[model samples]
Target: TNASPSNTQTPEHSPTTIAVVKGLAWLFGSGSKTSTAIRETRTAYDLCAKRDNEESKFIHEVCRLSPTYQTWFQIANLHVWMVRTRYRALPAPYGKAFEQEFVNHFFLDIEDRMRAALNHKAPERIVKGYLTEMRDQWMGATFSFDLGLVGSDAELSGAIWRNLFASRGLDGKGELIGKPGKIGESRAVADGKAALAELPFHLYVFSAYIRRELKRLESISDEDVMAG
Candidate 1:
């Protein structure tokens, strides 16, 4: 006897995939407060972009080269720093755990959006690997900046320059490449101090934005658990 069509079942979506989809939907939804924060952040970036300084030129170049990835990296770096600083008052272990969870969720949502935008689907293993690498990048950035904080402003500027521009040698595409032109790098280094000067204020705004989003998510999760 032939098997019935009911015997053929489609695979269910993974919890991570479902959560990412839902999270992104909520994040960009029409009435989302989170969307407001995102818009404000973009507005800040836009204002920064309008300047004709060397720092602005560097920012524009990176955005021009790899808009999506560069933009995501900048936001993620700030968010991770905010998480680390915010949780510093907690015990060491708990602080580390909270940072990891926050970073994981942030990257997951980023990956989902990236896949959607590119019209690509990666295997679970591949997705996990990407997440692992991204987490490592976050930790590396934190450690690098921590050291920079103890050193001179020049050291901090070097760290920022490396993270923002020098770290990735790739062009707009994913291919390997050399450093940016000498003139650009020279101008960037000269402008770096001024740019770094503005970061503390921006960081404060970003931290508040991130904290509000996290509390909003926690409240939703609490409501779901209670309803369940």
Candidate 2:
């Protein structure tokens, strides 16, 4: 008629088991935070990479850039760089990890584009060579822009001019190639001159956009950013 005494006792964990459980939690906790941060990086990248969106339209048509892969990269990379600055505002590990993961996605996307642009089955080294050059370009742009952020608006404008507006002259067929015809030579020269003349204005407008976006990002809820 009596109940067993062991049934009334609570199960207890040994010191070793408790320690192991704590250690495993730490491991997975760190990994999960990083994984969440990495997952959001794609959304951040898409902010610049989404096709024919307002950002792309402004870069291509209004800014007079040809719709080449290079132009797209410049646009994508510029926004990536901008958002990274704000990422620094996030708490320690998440901020650094997010910035790095965002960059990782950008380059991965670039490599895919390069493969398609060249032969789909292009040699790894060939695609890597282009990627190496791109890495250098990106490093230079970010360094210059970082200096610009701490300096003046003029400095930022100069950085944009050197990077984003560095798109090459395009031909009639929208290729960054071909020679001008007899009649076309005059038109090309005139167009080039006009573009040059408008360069200062566009640079100013782009600088404004950069400044505005950076400010706007600062205003967004941390929840939305962390959801990345």
Candidate 3:
């Protein structure tokens, strides 16, 4: 008797294939994603060669394609700083500044990693694997916008306390926790204000990265024109 097709078999999607599709979707979801990536790199390259804005340059260069992996390694150290500074008590202005810088650095690093994946000479499967890893890490508890330092219980507690105190305009000493009745009502307003400031920085960073990538693509297209 002829064997029948197995009805019990489930459809299989290879992880690598799924990853490539996901990465491509992420890459193309925005109209200017490629351009933003190029712009961020260009700015970093400009800053790096000039040796000015060294810290910003440092953050951007960490993920730049280069002979050394020092930049990548340095990026791996940023989460600690994110955790500590975000949790520490500071003046409102300083806290705002630190939060902006933290987000700026985060996107710069992410853009760099994505750029690396794009530049990798390995097979598409390997490239997609790298992108998939990024997606997985981001989807997990290690990263988030509302909460800084997602996985660390201590960091989370510290962030909550810091936010609570900051919302009340109190120093870490808790002096002003309940003094200002109008502002002491709720953290909701404070969080809303913070979100307004924080969200824009992230968008700016991502936009800059995409702009940079588009420029690179344009340059390559130009070269192709000249050669052709």
Q: Candidate 3, which segments miss by more than 4 Å at Cα?
A: 1-119, 141-145, 148-153, 157-228
lDDT tens digits, residues 10-93, model 2?
223233334433443453244346677667877878766764345656766666765556666677788888888887788776
Each prediction's whole-model lDDT (CA):
0.42, 0.63, 0.34
Q: After superposition, how far is residue 36 of candidate 3 from its true place, in Å?
A: 11
TM-score between model 1 and native? 0.43
Model 1: per-residue lDDT, tens digit, 69-100?
43445444654554345444344444343433
- CA lDDT, candidate 1, residue 156: 56
Best-first order by TM-score: 2, 1, 3
Worst 10 residues of 2 by lDDT: 181-190
Residue 112 deviation, candidate 2, in Å?
0.7
RMSD to the true structure for each prediction, in A, is 14.2, 17.1, 20.6
Better lDDT candidate (2, 3): 2
Candidate 2: regions farther than 4 A off: 1-32, 51-53, 167-190
